[model samples]
Target: MKKPMRLSTVAFFMILAGVAALGVAWWTQHKLGIMPCELCLWERWPWRVLIVLGVMVPVLPARVGRGVLWLCAPVLLVAEGLAICHVGVEWKWWPSPFPACHAAHVVGRTLAERWASMPLMPSKPCDAPTYLIPGLPVSMAVMGGVFACVVFVTLCVGMVRSKKIRRF
Candidate 1:
């Protein structure tokens, strides 16, 4: 084939990857009652960027669109990196880099003072990983890392093959 990538196909895949990641996260949070930690929420930003890129793709010319889509490589890497960091934190390899990931200290002599010092909403700790399946070994963060890696590799292969053709 002269071109392995069609503009529509690129756009569709971009949106698909983003939506799938976000949708799964949302489902686990709302349906399964799994709360996300601060780092987990931070990890979602790259997917959000992908969603925005997908929406912008169809409007651009084919070559320009493909060029823009190339940005996905780094974006995916960022997503994967965040997931891996989250996994490391879950495994206790190291402490979470985000301060928000730590539990707030409620120090006060009086009960009311302590209560007032505590966060209004109870935030999940980054070290506690969320497991979806009952017997599954992998945590959600690890799964997310795998997902990002797969998408990144797929995009790279497809783009590299297209680059060989020297036309977008």
Candidate 2:
């Protein structure tokens, strides 16, 4: 039989994964000059929460720590849902909830006024998807959903196995 992973180990891995994902996104934005859409920025919040949970899980009491680890499953599921929604927006299956996804409106009467009010660099449209791997036909949102699902499953299985071992 395979040995079940410790809760601390699971927590550590979750933190690492969260950081790595954010790092890649940052690299893409800063180094590659690829800007994220409003929805893309929204997708990152859950990962930040997960990183906080990961840190707390290792220091809390055993039962509480395990509970924290279990909490990760739902957090990741929500992240995946957000990513899926973003994918839908990208594919034009539905519209984004954020107004920034649409074109910016200039309320100014004069061209100079409009130019002054406009942002230096406009944000990317949410409907336009960015692929980390060129020609892969997979957008960052799709990849995020996949990663979230994988991590969710891992946390679920780990929690279940931990429970079984505790009962024995």
66 in model 1: Cα distance from truth in Å?
Answer: 1.6
Off by over 4 Å in 1: 1-3, 161-168
**Model 2 over residues 54-139: C-alpha lDDT tens digits?**
99986899889988888888889889999999999999999999998888887698989998888677989999999889679999
Reference-based lDDT, residue 12, model 1: 77
TM-score, one value per model: 0.92, 0.93
**Candidate 1: tens digits of C-alpha lDDT, residues 1-168:** 555666567667878999999999999989988888999899899999998887887899878878888988899999999998999999999999999899899899999999999998889999998988889988999999999999998887766655535446
Of candidate 1, the 10-residue stretch with the lowest lDDT total is 158-167
Strongest candidate by TM-score: 2
